[model samples]
Target: MNNYYILGLDIGSVNISAAIAKFSPDSDNLSISGIGRARTNGLKKGVVTNIEKASTSIRQAAKEAMKTAGCKPDRVVVSIAGAYTGSVKSQGIVSVPSGEISINEIKRAMQMAQDNAIIDKDQVILHVLPYEFKVDGQDHIEDPIGMSGSRLEVFTHVITAEGNSIRNLIKATNMAGLKIDNMVLAGYASALATLTKDEKELGVGLIDLGGATCDIVVHLGNSIVYNDTLPVGSTNITMDLSRALNTPLANAEEIKINYTKLLESGVSELQLPTMGEVSLTHEASMDIVTKVIYARIEETILLLLNKFENSGYLNKLGSGLVLTGGMSKLDDIRNLTSLMFDNIPVRIAKPRSVDGLFEVSEDAKNSCVVGLCLYGSGEFTRYEIDSNGELKYKDSHLKSMTSTKSVNSAPVIEKEKVEYKEDKSEDLIKISKISEKNAEDMHTFTKILNRLKQLF
Candidate 1:
């Protein structure tokens, strides 16, 4: 059984994570073979501050994962943070020379859309996601291939990132001895791992609150309509606590993760160490810590709310908000987010289930990495822009389905043929019995006629 292997790398400001997935085409099953994470100090928000340090971090994480999997992957799908990324909407139209839409025409339409989009000179297109298609004058067509049409058009969401930032990331990955197969938006990757089909169709909002950045994506209908990133994240809260309590940043991070309650109303006491001297400690009120954490979280949520409102998709979120990433583990985050968003439903989500994903699936922080693996396995949209920046139809799974049937159909057809022959044999037996009965009647008629002749 041939299997496909791919590694997913999520390079974050605070940490870098890598996961290996093995996908079996015969069974259509995806399984996680290994997972790795390492502390990183090379990135601030989404920008690579030090390529050497970032490359070291990536190498460590990938090495650990490869050790566990007992094999090294030739290529990887990596996540690009949303901080340095932006998207624009554009449309493309073309006259179909074949008078019908095919892969070539679809690719041309997507290329036209990319060419037509107005992008900054310092940025490059990462994805051209065509959400809606039109054939001739008809609109809202999802797939135009195999359909008769004189004209083909596509409406796309073009995701672009700063050229320098992208180059830096690619360089770091190359320095780590890894080749990148695809680069995905961090927010979209998290959404793919955590969101259900119903949530996506019903319109949902996803927020990936990591250490130094909060990435947001609004998925509506069949594709993401809007995405943005905020520089503030859970790290802001830790900084606030450190300043307010005169504690070390590491201690403040520990306190923020373990002590603060955002929605609690009770007061408590705590002991915190001073910034430079671990031996020097002082009493601090839990109320102060809670107040500081709440202030930062509220600010982050408010900023996100403003972005959502401006996106023109605020009212379209039927599935409300799904919160993920490391920050989502905070106590009562959902309650606070719900209240701030006017009581629209809210839930904290982790990565969806995959086979052999034991510990990693339990944390929301792994959503992006896991989703990257899924994307590598062709679990993303039906149509996607390839690494060459050209839109391609992903029909491998469909081809697998057809291949499976072709392999299995012969036996099934043969069984049906055998059953059909048995039925035919039963009909022949019934006909033979009827023939015998007819012969008996004929013989009885002849005897009656003979008896009548003798009487005469």
Candidate 2:
């Protein structure tokens, strides 16, 4: 059991789940030794509204995981998702030095594009993904490393969010007594664990339906081409059910899981009371509740469709939508989603391996946690610290802003990854998804602070 130890923690609205990896470095396959989970009470819609409350939930979950793993988790990777998360596209280009394009030139172009695209002062750029590069007149090139060209142009997908929201998340996590080793974008984490290389290369739309947020990621031609977060999630379905059935929220959720309806049943002959959990005096057909629930789910789908269509990724989809997350466990979910998008195949997906627990309907739910372990195990980006203890990018490849003085020069290369479970001493702590309990809602922040703010 001492093979290789890595901890992955996924903080969600409904539950906090963790996994300890028993690394079999001698083989390709991995085993998850101890999986721990606890109910989450301090979060709302995937964001921490109350730091103290959120911290309590995280600490409880971590403590359980630590006991199971038989050791304290000195280093951890946390997932981040909030209402402020969003995406946009940008392009960068540079004349080929000596009328010829090299791998370095292409890399420089990507950095330029990311630097040029960031317009908000308060927003923090999370991921700078170089989707594709065009060398001279040739296009659709995934890598032009050995190719020759007169100019190199790059198109990238930029994902960003409110900086304060991210800071709040970090603060709460620190308060919970866990040192975060890495910060991974939640949707990307989900994709890496669930999406096949072919699916990502051929272009697929991954829709992860969560409790409070529906995340949309468009992976096409090898990288994520677009991403966005919709405020609506599975919780909306519960709310709609409660309102339509005139029952309490808890009972509505119970009915959603326990009830069933024939796909073509234009009418539900079953009777349900509108007032309470255990009332039978008045009987109303159950069809109304089902249809109402279906309608709300459809609207959320439509919202995603609109985002995809408007982003021009609708036509580029070669691989159809892949849906996952705890919310994707609903019965006949594919059938309901199929009707919303024309000719698009919809299916539930889950983590391929390293499993012990999986609810039949929680394809999307496991993706993030599983992906976090996979991400921490594999090296993606690197970060460093200054005398002041602030976080700084270890490599130029990850810099959001290209320094004017260093733009034309080749940046220094560092030694590849070496393990260190050091605490983040004075690094930036991320707080995300400002809910009502966080003292100010995102809407309120946006309205009051009309001035633009810049962040890394």
Candidate 3:
């Protein structure tokens, strides 16, 4: 009967999405409890512009999720994306005094690698993911612990962001009456929810196209090698359409969303509801819309491709590309991307293996938030929210946990035992089925208990 809840909030330029999941002590699985979303304001290109407006959006989204889950969450794992987000790789080597690598030696090597990294004074490290360990010049050693080697070396990919940007996000979330549990790069989170084990192992690229930003992460050897965020995204296309067609922003958005289908239909003309029933011909409207959309999307994709090429990992990607987020849902985008990438394999990614409210679990736009929940299920640092809505670190180092002590009577469980293995597809399939069944059976009880717990 012991259950724990975890909340993941994705604050983006276009919208704020929140997802709540219940973790059970007896099972290493996450059951979706509720999901909520609200239109976002006060932000542009994933950076907070107005704290009060951003806080209001976050509060509204969280409140809707809390009402659906029937419990209030004091803390949340949040997703961050912007042009300032980036990653760099560094290597560290240390001599093992004992001639055998121990955990301490590994930690020291990682520390050395982190110290060797060159970062700006205003930047803060978000994640230091070790790609591999080498023992005595031997490469590809997954773990060096207990290995007899005079020297231990570690290669790590470190993610960093502008410190002020992070502070702004923290300030907005705090004002929303929620404490930050952990912050994950939006690209990393989306990859967690969409990219499969095979794709990651064989080398792949994930592109999360949001409203105002395009987040890119490259994975190889089952680890992140490079990540960056571009300032341009789907909103640019909408703006282009708005300007080229001389239409309102709302109407332009509608056209952009349906542009592909409209083009495919080969209609000569269309009537506009916004223009007082004025009829627009394809030669005038569709061509302009197509040209605007194509130009912007092409520019964005080329820029991303150039970044990948510059990273020197472009040739290493065997799985090609997996696209997710709101823009990926656009009709014909897959073909468009494929053509741009010279027919490299491209597929639109949807959230899978997530047992939750149907809409959120299946939506590409919710990938980051859902992935935040999945990321929070693993080992992470803990933060505390004071009564006055301030965030404080509970510890300096990352902590591992199997359950969370709720702020009230509700117990929260963490799915620490659940591990995703590349060769264990059958196991994952079985687990997915079991989770789905559990979700179905617990549907009623979850609603009732959540409502009851709200009274406390």
Candidate 4:
């Protein structure tokens, strides 16, 4: 067996997370090189704004990861999430003339549905999750690949993204000098690293709380059935603190991370930063802490849970809530999850059984990026590609493989004639527009400074 090294990167509005790991054929273990995180620039609310800034940060991140993993970059799978990603379940049915049907016919019928997929001009398909397949009039047939059937029906989950979202991401990665070998959704990455076989089988709700956005994914009966994202998270809490206490964003972040607790830590007022660990005491203004955070986190959870409930298939909370990400690290968040989710178990999901996790026991906090690397290294080998530009799968993307939901993996669209020819006309126009924008920004900055001087 050949040894393969994998790099996973999760890019967010506030931070860039990178991890490097190599797999050996001799063992089922992974050697984690290092994990790198840095404040993000050039992106806003999960979308790339300035390619130069994003690329610079990304380049630095890659270099840092390389140093940690002790290996130069070879391949990387980038993780993405944002507003433009939409998920839907579509089904196709066809009658087979013979009493028995081969896997080829069922698969071909599903392909016909995918062919008619609503791929718009500004969007690209990211995933094709198969929910269930039926034979003849039978329902919930797991795999029809070899089963005999007169009629084949497949239920699938199709995920699509805004073309510009991916285009800008690819552009930034290219500029940063990383090969865009694969693109995986941030939710999928987190699930891969956190959710277990039983959880996916019974149903699991994985919520990733990041700086600027919150990604929610529910895996029921072992495959992803529902996914929804909201444009708010830890950063909003930071902003609230900043505006409330008249402090810089950096200072507010410090307060939230070090002082804030899920429930009242029996204290209200806590120091911004006291050298190291925050000592929780009765004298601490527990009210103040909860007052600041409860509403913010409460509202966030309510909105997200409500969205999941509305989905019908996700409200049951079968596997409970597994919260991850930087924001999920807030002390006692598990308590809040219980109050908000009710009856369903809520626990912090950590990345166990992966290499280099000893430095941080809370691997779930960075689960998405790390999981991306693990899954990128053949963990999501549910996809198959043959000669010609055709992509085939054993089942739809949402079907569970083991006891858990077996996501078909990110869909592969056959490479087409990429018109990479330089758009000289558009390039020239873009340059002029960029120059004009820069000049306008400088003028605005100067105006603000002048106004401040006048006030002083």
lDDT string for model 1 (1-456, tens) is 567677899989888999998877778788899899999868888689998889899999999999998887644789989989998898878778767678888777776666567666666677778788888789878678899978887888887778668767876876787766678888888988999999988989999999999999988776787889988888888889999999999988988777535235354777779988869999898878878877888888999999888999989999899999999988778999999999999989999889986788998999999999887776777676643353446676445433332221101100011222222122110000001112245577765653343222
The better candidate by lDDT, 2 or 3, is 3
How does candidate 4 score on lDDT?
A: 0.66
Off by over 4 Å in 3: 97-100, 260-268, 273-287, 379-399, 402-456
Summarize candidate 4's per-residue lDDT along 1-456 as a digit string, tens digits. Answer: 445567788888888988887766456566677778777999987788998899888888888988887886445778878556876566666666565767556555555445445545555666666667778778866666667756777676666666567767767776776755567778878888888888887878888888888888888653677777889989898887766655567767777887644244545455443223345312234455557777798888888878777878565567788898888878767898788776578878777566664553365567888777766555652432211113445343122212122111222353332333122222110100001112234567765653343222
Error of 3 at 142 (Å): 2.0
Top lDDT prediction, candidate number: 1
Q: Tell me model 1's lDDT, rounded to 2 decimals.
A: 0.78
Where's the lowest-lDDT run of ten residues in candidate 4?
A: 428-437
Instruction: State every prediction's TM-score relative to the real structure.
Output: 0.84, 0.74, 0.79, 0.79
317 Cα displacement, candidate 1 (Å): 1.1
Per-residue lDDT tens digits for candidate 2, residues 243-359, read: 876777876777666655433455555455556546553444676866876787778878988888887888777778888987787766787777777868776898766644444
Cα RMSD of all models vs. native, in order, equals: 23.3, 9.9, 15.2, 13.8
For candidate 2, what is the TM-score? Answer: 0.74
Ten-residue segment with the worst summed lDDT in candidate 3? Answer: 428-437
Best by TM-score: 1
Error of 4 at 327 (Å): 1.3
Q: What TM-score does structure 1 among the candidates reach?
A: 0.84
Please give the ranking of all candidate structures by lDDT, highest first, separated by commas. 1, 3, 4, 2
